[model samples]
Target: MLSEQKCEACSIDAVALNKGERDTLLLELSDWHIIEREGIPQLEKVYKFKNYKQAWAFSNKVSELAEDEFHHPSILLEWGKVTVTWWSHSIKGLHKNDFICASSCDGFVENE
Candidate 1:
């Protein structure tokens, strides 16, 4: 889990990647969505499955990655969809962590 109070900035430049980048990333990922929320780069992904069991499994996978990165995102789990919002809680804004996690989430989608 990410420490919500720390405001450490990342060295990797953070920019709200455009559609081209998002599209390219999406080719290898299907469960994640790249979005710009409140003028910031955000990953608004919705993982769809037939039932809750699969959603829970994917949520766990995401949690594992979040724990490792120490940059946690907001997650919403439903019966068939899991929405993940990624941003740097530390910086209280966007950061490279968002992109890193977005990329990692993409890989997870591809692998699954």
Candidate 2:
């Protein structure tokens, strides 16, 4: 499972996932969607919470996880929801690490 995997170091020259690979990995992440920003594809998901406190806490957890994995994401924390967009800036597109991190983020709210 993606959550069981660890993110590897992504260099500037690393190749992004092809369309087939991206679609396959995305199948494992039902709640996430592929979106384009500034012409770059990204994996994005909006997690809902009961309150702002819950949303904020979830965002912090994701932040800690990102730091641990050394693969960061663009996290937008708002009232009762947090939108996380993951992409390898080095490659300017989706990477395996993004799917892995997205899977981990899903785990954070499995009980919710």
For model 1, how many clashes?
A: 0
Writing each residue's lDDT as its tens digit, candidate 2 over 1-112 gives 8978989888767899999999999999968999999999999999888999999999999999999999999999999999999999988999999999999999999946
Model 2 TM: 0.95
Which numbered prediction scores highest in TM-score against the true structure? 2
What TM-scores do the predictions have? 0.65, 0.95
* Cα lDDT over the full model 1: 0.66
Over 1-112, each residue of candidate 1 has an lDDT whose tens digit, in order, gives: 2212222346555544456765654565445566666666566677687899888888888899888767788889999888889876444455545656766665666687
Off by over 4 Å in 2: none
Worst 10 residues of 1 by lDDT: 1-10
